[model samples]
Target: MDRAVQRTDHDAIASKLSAVKRGYYEDEYLELFCPRFEPRLPLINIGTWCRVRAIDQAITEFLEKNTEGKTQVISLGAGSDTRPFHLLPKHPNLVYYEIDFPTQVRKKAAIVRRHLSQKVELCDSATPVTLEGDINTSRYHLLGQDLRQLSLPDLDESVPTLIISECCLCYLAPESSHLVLEYFASRVAHLSIVLYEPIGLDDEFGRVMAENLMMRGLCLPTFQKFSTLDSQTSRLRELGLTHTISAKDMEQYYNDLPSAEQKRIHRLEFLDEVEEMNLLLRHYCVVFAGK
Candidate 1:
């Protein structure tokens, strides 16, 4: 299987696992992955739920306040993510754009067409070629572009934009990641960027985490390069984003979540691995930057 396909497959599996545990919103489409992988560990399910919840909250807050003009959301490396479908009904005026490698985009396009043809519009057969691939669209536009090259689709700069990179940046080399950030910062006028990535790689747990990923031939090139809140904030600042805020870890993010919401998710599973969960949460961080 293609690398992009493999990554997306893993993501689908994770989503399905989290849904099975009832840790977040249900994604019935992810059930397609059930034959390939059994239920994932409770820890994996919880981690996936936390990440999804954080990003969802950020986008919700953004959409709730900025309900003017043509609101846009650009999701980078949006492999197998169904956020657009979830957001469309709430904000029918918003235009969503998802970019990823060609293989991933093609696969996702087919899936969306099969399941949501009535809701989305796939561009005509003669889709214009820019890089090595074309884009399919509806309310959501899914484009095929190499993140390393960083060529964004034609977009209205005047519109308030929300850019998301959930667990996506760590896969790129530090320079490439910076280039991606700089591309957006230079173009989008009013923008908010929400990044979810692993950090805290200076300790034993971090080392083990890094080694485990490496052993699977997965490289987190920018993990240690921006492994703390200060480094993450500084990176955004250097890239020209004005106001930046970062959570030290998921623990902080979880603490900051609403009490009712926290109780809801905690009740989803019988979590017994308190110590391990804390250590896991401490290794991941959420950073938000805007101009």
Candidate 2:
């Protein structure tokens, strides 16, 4: 398989696996071979996990408020996300479109099928509901076209649409990310994006943590430019999304974990260096937007 295809495949598989098994470490796919046996920092994990939970809650709320029986959801780079099936119990008639590169989409569909089958067969009371339509489409329904030259049609102007980018945005060049956002806002009646990423802490500890991760041969983020909360808020203002959710709760969560969990978390270089940066080392976010 092509390298890009392989990565996407991994993305879909890893994401779903993480969500399904509550106790599994998120970086296990990478750390399985090289385990972090040392005590880890609980605060670090708490901070990161909190952001993810917040995104899930925000999307869930959006679905409950807007979905009457016919709303559509487009999860960009929808790696192994089970939100579609999970949400089905709440709103069985809504349609979900998980879009990604072909290989990822194929693998995710297979996973979903296998998971549903096991659920039905193993659990006496389990009831499975099918997601509507063919899984693959050359022209996706929302954009239904290549993103490079995206220009969404106005035919479905009245439909309530929610676009989720998640952690996928930071990987794209900022310009490309911005263009995609612009396209969605223009086309969708309502839109929400959840971004989780590393930002510059500028403190000595923050810098050291990031560098130490690189030294340890972990995935180093290619894009490292981070803006202050004010700057980030301004950008969203330009895009007409004004709601904000700060990730500061994550730091607290990590710090509050029991001693054993804290050890696993503190082992990571980033967590150890957080305090050295004048408390600037942290996770931050903005979730509010208007159509």
Best by lDDT: 1
Residue-level lDDT of model 1, residues 1-291, one tens digit each, is 237434744664565565554646676556533435456656667777778778887898789869875789999988877778768766867889898888777776766765654454333345532232344444567887878887655777888888999888888889999989888889888888989889989999999998987777777879979998778878887877768744457878777778997788777777788888888988998888788
- Residue runs of model 1 more than 4 Å from their true location after superposition: 1-9, 12-16, 20-23, 32-37, 120-135, 245-248
Candidate 2, overall lDDT?
0.48
Error of 1 at 155 (Å): 1.8
Residue range 70-169, candidate 2, lDDT tens digits:
6666776565554555554456445566665555555545544445434422112333334532242221221223344545443355666666765555
Instruction: Candidate 2: list runs displaced more than 4 Å.
Output: 1-45, 67-69, 114-155, 205-226, 243-281, 284-286
Candidate 2 TM-score over all chains jointly: 0.62
For model 1, what is the error of residue 150's alpha carbon versus the real structure, in angstroms, after optimal superposition?
2.2
